[model samples]
Target: MTAAVLSVEKFTVSMPDATASTPALGLGQDIDNCVPFMTVSSDNEANEAQMVDVKKNGGTNKFDFTATALGARDLEVTVVEFDPAQVTIEEVSFTLGSGLTANVTVGTIVEANTFPIVYAHSAGDTTDGYDHVMMRATFTSTTNLQIIKQVHQADLVGHAYILEALNGQWSIETGASIPLAYTTAQTTKNAAITVTANRTGLWSYWDTSDIGDDPRDSIWDGVITDATNLDLTRANGSTPSADGDIESFVVNFAADVAVVQQGEFNYVTAATKTAAISAPGTLGNTMVVATNAYGWCESTGVTVARATCQGRMTFNSAIEVLGTRSGFGNGEYRQNFQVIEWLIGGAAAAAEPIIIMLGY
Candidate 1:
C-alpha cells in the first residue's frame, strides 16, 4: 500500500467581486479563476490557541480546560523569483473583477481588499483512488506585504516579496484540480555585444626628439581593435622602417585586470628593440626608464632631487629609493625594497644631501 502523505504543489488566490452574490463561505462569489501563485522560496504557517484552565483548591493539577479567546492562524509566503506578466494584474497596480478577464490597470493606487485563497496538494493514497486534495480559505486578508531588495550574491536571489495571510477561515476538498493556466519560468541570457563602427587613432605618443616639436612629426597612433587588443602604427598608417621610429609595443594585462576574468592571460606585443633608455630629473618632469630599472642613493651631504621614474616617485629623504618602472609590456609592475633613514648626531646640515644612481 502506498503512503497517504502529500506535498503542496500549488497555491492560488481569487479576488472578491462586489457585484456578484456571496458563496456558501459567506465571503464573495466563487469565480474560481484560481490564478497560480508565483515563484515562492518558502511557505510557513503558524497557529495560536487560547484556553482557560479550571482547578480545585486542594488539587495538584488542572481539572478541566476551556476555550476563552478566539484562535488565530497565519500563512506567510516569500517569493525570490516570479513571472511579471502573470502577476502584473494581481501584484502590481491593477484590480481584478468578476473573472480573470476583467482586470484593470489602476495606476499606482492599490486597494485594500479581502479575497479567497487555495492550496492544492499532490496526489495521495493511490489505493483509495483519490486524484488530489485542495485547501480553500475564505475571508483571507493580506498583511505585511514587504518588498526586500539586497545585494546580489552567489544565490542569484534578487528581489524578495513577502505576503502574510490573516483571519484564516478554511476548508479542505478531496480530488480537486487546478483551474487556471500558468506560464513556465523563462531563461533570460546575457545580451550580445554590438559594434557599429571601428574607432581608430584613439591615442598617440611622441618620441624623445619630438617632445617639443610638432606632434604629427613623430606621433605613433594607437588603434583599438576590440575590448582587449590595441595596435600601434605611424600616424600615416605605415610600419616603422628606420631607427628611432616606433618599433613595436606590447601591453601585458595583470592577473586581476578590471572586467577581465581572473587567471586568464592577456597580452599584446608590437616590435623589437636593442637597448632601453632612462633619464632622471626633478618632480613634474617626465622621465622614461626601461624595465627593471633601480634607483639608489650613492653618497650623503647633497640635496637629493625628487625624480619621477617611470610612473613612480622616490621618497623625500631616505638612504635608499625604490620606484615603479614603465616601458615594459606589463602594466603597473612593482618591486618592494627596504628604506633606511640616516640620522647623524652633531649639528644638522642646511640641506640633506644624497646621490641618486640608476641601474638595470
Candidate 2:
C-alpha cells in the first residue's frame, strides 16, 4: 500500500511586544495594537519564497507544523514578522520529531534541510535584525509498513556486525558494536551497526556467522571465528535501514596480531663438520649426528655456506667432503658427510631452515 508520514518541525516565534525606549502605539508602533502578520521564509532578507504555515498542533506562542521530511542533513529556516512597520527580530530555532533530526541552531536561523526551500525575511533595520519561524518540507518515500513495524517490535531481531573470516565463514555478534556498518546515526526509528577490519577493504554482504539461522538467505562474507570467544569490540553507526540501502566504505587497517618476539641465531650443519668445514655461519646454530656422532665438535665449524651449497648439504643427507686428516686414509681424506644445519626462508628462497633460537 502507498503510505507516507508527515515529519513535524516546530519552532516558537516571538517579538518584543513593547520596549521601554521604543515608539508608543501610534499608527504602527506597539505589537498588540498593530496587526502582526507572521510568515516563514528561508532567507533573512525577506525577499524570497514564502513557507506553507501548517498550524499543526495547538501551540500558541509556538508555530507548530510538520513538513514532509527527507534524509538528515542540513536545513535553514527563516521567520518573517510583518506589519505596516516591521518589528526587530532575532534568531529562529526549530525542533524536529521522529526520523527528522537537526544539528545546529542559531537563534531563529539555520541552513537548508535535506531539501532546499528558501524563505525571505524583511527586517525593520539591518542592525536590529529580522526573525521568522521558517523551516522546509522534505518528502521521503519509506519502506513497506509491514517490514518497518516488524523492525521495531519488542521481539525484533537486534542489529548486527558481521565478523568475517578468510575461509568465507562469518560470526554475528548482536547487541554489540559493529564498525563501518552504519553510515547514519542511531534514531528512534532505526539503528546502524558497522563491521570493519584493518588492511582489508570493505567486503561483500557475505559474512561468517555462528548465530541465528545460517543467514544463508542473504549474501555473506565467509569464515568467521567462534562466537563469544573472539575480538567482539563493536562500534555503533548512524541509523541504517535493514532493507537494501548500501553505503560505501573506506579502506582501513585493523591489526590481527602484534609481533610478540623477534629473534636471530646461528648454528652448524652435518655435512660441513665432516667435510673440511667450508664456509659456515656459526657452530651450534644447528648440529646433527648423521652418519657420524658428536655433532658439535665433529660439528661443522663456523662458515657461511652459499645458497646452492646450503640446500644440497641440508636436505640431500650427503655431500662430498674433502679433508687433510691423515689419521684415517691416504694423504687426503675425502668422504660423504650429511648436512648439519638447515636454513629456511633466508634473505631469499632456496635457503634451508636456519637455526632460529628464541630469546626472552
Candidate 3:
C-alpha cells in the first residue's frame, strides 16, 4: 500500500520522573520588589529582566498574550517554574526610538594670570640692619610731648599697620584704628596740614627707632618713611588735650555711610536753640529770618548754642537737608541746603511775601 506516503511531524511527550513535580512558570506577570534580575547590554545600551506581579494566588487567571512590539522593553516573571512547567518567556527585544535623545551643554574651560603691586616701599632704613620698606606717609604730632600719632596709607582699606615710636625717644604706641576726629574746636593734633587720613597704630613691637625727633616743645613731626599693611597707623586719631576728651568715636565700617542726594540728610531737624521754645518746626514754618541757620539736630552731649539766630537765622536765612531718597539707588547724604540762597523778604524775593520753607 506504499505506506500511504506519509511525511510525519513527530510530537514527543516526556513523562515526569518518579519524584516531586515542578510548579508552572509565570509568563507576563511581574515580581514583587524583583529578585535575581538579569541585566544585559547590546550596543552600549543596557536592559533588565526581572520578576513581575501576576496578582494570582495560584488561581485560574486568564493570561494575555500581548507582546511589546516597540521601544525599551523589559521582561519579568513572577512565578518560577516548579511543578507542571509550561509557558516560557524567552528573549525580549526592544526598539528604543527617539526615547533617550538629550540636549547636553558643554562649557569651555579657562585659565588665569597674575600681576604686581603698584606702590611698593623701599627696604633697609636703619643703622641696625633691619629691612624696612619705604613710602611717603602723612603723619601728625602734638606739642604735648605725649604726641598723638596718625597714619594714612595710600590704600586706607588695604592693610592694618601701626606706628609705634614717633621720632625716636617718643615712646608712644598708637591704636590700630582711627578714632573719628571732628570737633567744634580743631586740634593741632587733629589731621595735620601735610598729613590727613593718615592715622597710626603700633600693631607690632619695634626693636629700634625709626621716628626722627622733636624740634622744641613737646611739639614734633614725623617722616612717613614707611608704608605697610602691618599696623602702620601713620596719622593721629587724638584730639588736642585742649579739645577735651570729646568722647572720640569712629565712623566705622558700621557707621552710617554719608548719604548723598541733592546731597543732604533727609530727616534733618534743625533748631534756632531758642532758650525758650519747644515743638519742632513743621516743613512750612517759614517766617523769614535774618541769617541762615543751617541747623540740623546734632546732639553734642555738651551744649553748643549759637550766639543768636537773630542775625544769622532770619527771613533771608536758608538751610538744606539731604538723605536716602527712594526711586534712587544708594543710601546717601549730601548738602541739599546751602545757606547761600537764604533770603529774607525785603521786596524782591522769589517766594513773594517772604514765604519761608522751614526744616527741610
lDDT of each: 0.18, 0.18, 0.17
**Poorest stretch of ten by lDDT in candidate 2:** 144-153
Candidate 2 local lDDT, 244-297, one digit each (tens)? 221112112223210011111111222222233333232212222111110001
lDDT of 3 by residue, 1-360 (tens): 011001101111111111111122223323211111111001100001000111222243221111111112121111111111111112111111122111111111110100001111111112111111111121222200011112121111111111121112111223212232223233232321111112211111111112221101111112222222211111123321111111111111101111111111222123221221121122221221110011111111111111110011122222332121112211111111111111111223233221212111
TM of each candidate vs. truth: 0.13, 0.13, 0.14
- Compare candidates 1 and 3 on lDDT and give the better one: 1
Model 2 misplaced regions, further than 4 Å: 1-150, 155-199, 203-214, 222-243, 252-360
Model 3: how large is the Cα RMSD against the reference?
40.8
lDDT of 2: 0.18
RMSD of each: 34.4, 35.4, 40.8
lDDT of 2 at 233: 12
